[model samples]
Target: MAPPQPKAAAKAPAAPKSRVKKAKLGKARNYDLGNGIVRFSKTKMFHKTAKYKFVGKKNPKAPKTKKATIAVKPIGGEKNGGTRTVLLRRRKSFYPTQDKIKTHRHHKCFRKHERNIRPNLTVGTVCILLAGRHAGKRVVLVGVLPSGLLLVTGPFAFNSCPLRRIPQRYVIGTSTKIDLSDFKLPAHLNDAYFKKNKKSAKRSVKRKEGEDIFATKKEKYVPSEQRKTDQKLVDEAVIKAVGKREDKKVLRGYLKAAFGLRSSQFPHRLRF
Candidate 1:
């Protein structure tokens, strides 16, 4: 080996510096990393050594003051060396829970008290007609008019009476007791019933006349002559009606007795 190469100098290893130590600042619920790194607890916030500084004391020379109260002045205050006067300021009140304001509508213009109308005259009142063409009649008041006229209906026959003829005094609108027995229904004549009853009465009279006509007594002489003449005419009629019927035994007997005809006799045919 060539003169044992000058023994190579032994290489010296580089010295290792200390790893960054995790730091603990005061009781800030946080940790610090060496070389100016700060870690906030439970948050990912980080700060450099220069940016993250300790909180310092507040300034001590600042002035202090208390809150001021609001001031109210009178509206009509006098100026210096001038006359003073009084002024009133009124504000309308608003009540949300108060009852509603009352308003009236459709009040009657007709004064009941002024007119002396009985207080008892209410709606659906019944009244009677006192003076008119149909006096002593009854009616019902439908309403009171604005002109103080009473609107009434029926005395039945006197339904068309004017309002002027009706007196307020006689018109008893409110009565707890009304005797109805004296009141009669309106008179109405039925021509059909009258005609039927008259016809029946006439027929009864005719029947009695017919009986009398049939029942009159006959005079002895005149009646006998009449009987003979009537019997002859009746015989002719009977002979004409019967013809030549010897087969009817009862008819033959009647003819024999009525006419003086024998059973075997040849009778002449007589025209009536």
Candidate 2:
């Protein structure tokens, strides 16, 4: 028996309700096209009209703005030289944001404002080591050098900041400032001070005569024995300044929090 002929699918027009739900609606910006002709478009961005010019009876006179002028020195006379007035050209800046302006010296427009990345590099500033074998290590700012250099230390036994002068560019400065109120370290802290202090500290370690029987003969310390001693002294001052424990791990957490860094960001003991 022949099966009933397949029924043809009926075509149904889209309903108005379905079409309304599927359509997208957005407010478009109105642009001045002159001559009362208004255009509505999604491609055009909305902007407020520029400064209004008052010429009606409500406010008859237009306000006058003062002109800007700057003093300029003659060529090759920057140091101890007389200056002359240079009139600046006033123009309407179409830039929406100040960041769009370029920064340059000796030009019509000068951008004096700059970001000071290392501004927090003051005395007792705790920092994170950014490079070398000790990358990610923490250090405390104990002394500042006159040449804008930093004298930092890790209290080596704790964080490995050796007593050395490093350039400010190397370490990452944190807003967390440490205290050095009672620290009487000399302005010029050198390797000699560390060597001498370490030696004195080793001699101060008291040991009984019979204590050496089982003890292996200690090899001469290469700034090793004194490091612990210096660490103690450094830690004491640091603890006083920061009012918080100077544990390396704790400071690592501080660095992570201050910079909003992830644990995977700085690899521990990274040679880089």
**CA shift of 82, model 2, Å:** 45
Give the Å error, residue 241, model 2: 3.1
* TM-score of each candidate structure, all chains considered together: 0.20, 0.36
Error of 1 at 118 (Å): 0.9
**Which residue ranges in model 2 land beyond 4 Å of their true spot?**
1-118, 191-221, 224-229, 244-272
Best by lDDT: 2
lDDT of 2 by residue, 1-272 (tens): 99899988998987666434556775545755778555743323222432233324384588889655664646555584555656566557686665567865442332333324365677787777766666676777887654445677775546545676667777877666666767877533564443343334223334568676444444354666555566567667765554454665565455333222567776454432
The most accurate candidate by TM-score is 2
